[model samples]
Target chain A: MTTISIIGSGNMATAIGTRAAKHGHAIELMSRNTAKASALADQIGHGATVAALGATPAGDIVIVAVPYTSAVDVVTHYGDALAGKILVDISNPFNADASGLATTPDSSAAQEIAAAAPEGTPVVKALNSVFGHVLAHDTPLDVFVAGDDAAAKAQVAAFLESIDLRPLDTGGLGMASVLEWTGILLMGLARNGAGFDIALGAEVR
Target chain B: MTTISIIGSGNMATAIGTRAAKHGHAIELMSRNTAKASALADQIGHGATVAALGATPAGDIVIVAVPYTSAVDVVTHYGDALAGKILVDISNPFNADASGLATTPDSSAAQEIAAAAPEGTPVVKALNSVFGHVLAHDTPLDVFVAGDDAAAKAQVAAFLESIDLRPLDTGGLGMASVLEWTGILLMGLARNGAGFDIALGAEVR
Candidate 1:
């Protein structure tokens, strides 16, 4: 069982924390709202704990669950505290209307957070493609991951596998931008005709 | 049977023409290279014919199977001749190394072609997510389509359905940019781990 530290008390944070807890992994919830974080920890139940925001993340795998706008700030706040831990970025930098990506090809949310993170911190982009409700409901889905560090990606993939989700690695951190576009693509598909409950996956022939 | 005119004598033209012909659609191959076009026509075999480049395309639905760089030139060259025909843009504006999209969010190949196209001509972006080789292999796959006109999208969707491929409408022509990004996402997936034989699709829960 792995220990996963998730920052933020948003829908994605709650979903990931609840699922990880259900899967027998230790979960550490961190949020600015201490009451909300404490409540979330209590709700998760399997020895889940709430850590003060910006305190050293207890888990080896730290998931930044805040919005893309705040992801960099949270990581910068954590600073050296996140070094040596695998930082997981699950933020989708969607524009105001959710039509296109707010991040450019040169700067994805993961890349920005990596820039702000302390040296030697491995930032991996994952789970941004999935809807919070679907993830929370225990639906088995494919999670596309991107990171510069192979070991970090492997560890995140293992965690995803433990929770009954398939992990598809799409190469280095450069692909975090592609993955961001993919987040927009998923929204476009869901809003258009595929419906909101749909998940994108690769079908091998 | 809908008459489908394909521009270019390249891999995509051959693949789409061959498949549409097998599905009993009248295939018209148009190319700057008459000899190559004729060879492709002979290869398609089912009432397939070659049309002179820049001349009026005989089919109501015309598929521009050229590269993104040349797509606008081809459309602009056709001008009023393609006024009412439904133009299908399948060009993926990939950079030299195929790492990301060459076109910006404001100008996808479809949008560019649409801007160069004659007034009242409906331009739909489809068959781009699938690789040319995969489309030629008779494997049924989902084809994501985007266009401004509802009737045009419905017609293209019907044609896709007739060919035994699922048609997923991803909204209007503005979504052409999203589809282009999706094209890059697919390439990133293929090059990374999904393999070249994989196809991306929406999995509905």
Candidate 2:
């Protein structure tokens, strides 16, 4: 079982942590709200622990589950503490009203987080395209991932597989921008006709 | 059966024309190259006829099956001839190497074509997310459509349904930009690992 550290106590963080924990993986909850973090850890059970916001994460894979605006800041604050760790960025840079992305193709949230992260820290973008509640459900969903490092993507894919989620790698970190757009597409679909429970999948025909 | 007028004798035109004809829809092929358009019409069969490039399209729904760069020009040239007709924009504003979109979200190919069309012309963006060959296949695939006019979008959705394709309306014309990025995402998925035979679908779970 792998140790998965989530840096936020929000909906996404809780969903991913709970699922990972249910899959026999240890979850290290790191949040500025100590009480909330501790409560989340207790709720997850199975040896789940709470870590300080800026402390070195115990998990090999660190998921920055914060908002898009704070993702880079969180990584920068972690500094060298995140060195050699696989940083997973699941932030969607949606503009106001969710019509378009706040970040451009040149500087997606994952790209910005990678820039702020310490050297040797491999940052992967996953779980950004699916809704938090859908992910919370115990169903196999397609998770599109993008990262420059091959081994880092493989690790994230393996973790997703362990949680009964299918991972579809969409190429290097540059494609992370496309994944962000995909999040917007999902929102558009949900708001229009496809509804919120729908997930995007690749059908071989 | 709808009379589908396709303005281009390219890969997309052939794919869409052949499929529409097989579904009992009459196809009117219009292209700068007379020989190529006639050849495509003959290949499509079922009374598929060739029309002059600038002539009023014989079909109620005129699909501008040309490159992104030439879509607006073609619409502008059609001018009042396209008035009161449903225009479908299936061009992907893909930048060189397909790494990024050539058009920004503010001015997608659909929006540009809409702006250049006659006052009553309703330009709907569809068939941009999937590959041409996939559309040529017999299997039903999800077709995402975007348009500002509800009636026009309904017509396009009905056309897609008649041809055994599911239509998912994203939203207004603004969502067309998201659909453009989705094209890039599909290319990324194909080039990375998913292969070219895959189609993006909305899985309700």
Candidate 3:
């Protein structure tokens, strides 16, 4: 079983940790708030445990499930603890008010996180497209994975499949911007009654 | 029958004009290059005709299908001729290399087209997401429509249905930026081997 560490106790982190535990993977939930993380750990049961933010858990995968504004700071706080591990980024940099697209021209939220992580950390982008409701309900949603490391991507793909979700490989790490922007577009579609509950995955005939 | 005036002689203009004609809508192809427009008109056959750029054709809808850089210029050149008509903007402000998204932080290609059109012109955003290959092949594709005018949106929806394409109403003119950004994201997906031939449309079960 692949050991996994989740670096946030928010909705996404909880969803991933619970799903990973259901797949029989060893899981660790880390956060600054010990009570919340411990509570989540209790709820998930199945060998899942809560650890402090700086705890260097021995895991092959680490999922960073923090908000876009605090993603860099969270990654920096984890520092070399994440080095040589497969780091998954699931954040979108869109503004809450829905005025316009919110990332700088030169870089995106995933890229920022990757830059903050220690060298050889192997950052992968995935799971930012599906809604939190779907995540919590364990719906069979499609997940897009993009990263430069083929082995890391394959591992994440296996983990996604274990949760009964379709994992689509969307090429390199640079393609994360497209995946991130797709979330913003989905937000607009949902706000306009186009049904945000829907998740988009490409079908090849 | 709804009269639709298309303001370009490119591949997209031809695809939309041909599909509109197939749907029994009165179609007129307007472009500075009359020869190219006439050739496309000849290809589309029935219920379609080529007209000069300056000619004022009576139509309930005017579609501006041009490149992002030229969309504003085309709308400004048409000026008051499009007054009181439903102006459809199908341009996306993506960089030439298609490496990243490039639009003004506060506005997009659709907003710029709306700003340049004559006063009282109801500008709607549609057909920006559908690929030309998909549009030309007569396959079922999804067309996203957005604008501030309800009646104008209805008219566009009717035209979309007539073409056997799904029309998703994404809401108000401000949302055009979101739709245009989707085009950029789609382009990125296509460039990364996700198939550009696909168009995103919804089906309610």
Better of 1 and 3 by lDDT: 1
Model 2 over residues A116-193: C-alpha lDDT tens digits?
A: 999768989999999999999879899899999999899999999999998988999999989999999999999998
Looking at candidate 2, what is the lDDT of residue A64?
97
Candidate 3 on B1-205: residue-level lDDT in tens? 6778999989899888887888788889999889988888899888588877856756778888878888888788878777778888888777776654467656777778888988778888988877876788777677778889899888888888888877777778887877776676566556656686756644321
- Candidate 2 lDDT, B12-44, residue by residue in tens: 999999999999999999998999999988899
- Among these predicted structures, which one has the highest TM-score? 2
Question: Candidate 1 residues B1-205, lDDT tens each?
Answer: 8899999999999989988999999999999999999999999999899989999999988999999889899899999999888999999999898877888757788999998999878999999989889888878898788999999888888888888789888888998887887788788788888899988888785
- Candidate 3 stretches with Cα past 4 Å from truth are A148-151, A169-172, B202-205
Better of 2 and 3 by lDDT: 2
Error of 1 at B29 (Å): 0.5
lDDT of 3 at A59: 78
Better of 2 and 3 by DockQ: 2
Model 2 interface DockQ: 0.82
Deviation from truth (RMSD, Å), model 3: 2.4
| TM-score against native, each model | 0.97, 0.98, 0.91
Clashes of each: 0, 0, 0
How well does candidate 1 reproduce the true complex, by DockQ?
0.72
Please tell me which model should have the higher TM-score, number 1 or number 3.
Answer: 1
